[model samples]
Target: MAESATALAIMGMALVTYLTRVGGLFLAGRLPTGRRWRAALTAMPGVILVSLVAPLVLGAGVAEAMGAMVVLALARRVALPVVVVAGIVVVAVGRAWLTG
Candidate 1:
C-alpha cells in the first residue's frame, strides 16, 4: 500500500512537471516578441541558473564551493555535459576527502 501510494505521488508530480513545461511553451508562443522581451527571455535561463547556484556556493560546504569553481573554469572550454560530469566528480571527491 505504501509503495502504491509512493508511485501515485511520483506520477502526479511527473504530470505536473510535464503540464508546466507544455504550458510555458504555449504561453511563450503568445508572449511579446519585442527587442527587450526577447532579450529578457534569452537571458532567463542564465538568470535562473545563477539563482539556483548562488545559494549553494554561498551557503554550502567546501565541496559545493569547489564544484562551483570547477564548473566556472570548465564552462567555456568544455562541452556542457563534460562540465556537469566534472563538477559532480569534484563534489563527490571533495566531500569524501574533506568529510571522511
Candidate 2:
C-alpha cells in the first residue's frame, strides 16, 4: 500500500541519516589521517547543522530570518533554553508587527 511504502521510505531515510552521522564519529575516533582530515571531521557537525537549517531560513520571510540571526547572536553567549526563548519571542513579535 502507499501508506506502507511511505513509512518504509521514511525509515530508510532515517537509517541512512543515522549511519552517516555515526560513520563520521567512528572515522573521527578510529582514524588519524592528518590534521586537515581531523579538522574536516571536527567541522562536520556544524556543516551538517547549517545545511539543514540554511534552506529553511533562506526560504522563510524576514521574520524567520531575523529570528535565525538572533539565535546565532545569542547562541554563544547565552544558554540554549534562553536562546530558544529569545528566538521564539523575536519571531512571534516580528510576525505580529509585520502583519499589522
Model 1: how far residue 92 lies from native, Å = 2.9
lDDT, candidate 2, 1-100, per-residue tens: 9999999999999999999979966765677679998788779889999899998787888999999999999999989999999999999999999999
lDDT at 46 for candidate 1? 100
TM-score for model 2? Answer: 0.57
Superposed by TM-score, candidate 2 places the C-alpha of residue 29 at a distance from the truth, in angstroms, of 9.7
* Residue pairs with backbone overlap in model 1: none
Q: Cα lDDT of model 1 overall? A: 0.94
Clash count for each candidate, listed in order shown = 0, 0
What lDDT does the true structure give each of the candidates? Answer: 0.94, 0.91
Per-residue C-alpha lDDT of model 1 across residues 37-80, encoded as one tens digit per residue:
99999999999998997998868989999999999999999999
Error (Å) of candidate 2 at residue 72 is: 1.8
Estimate the TM-score of every prediction. Answer: 0.62, 0.57
Report the CA-based lDDT of candidate 2 relative to the real structure.
0.91
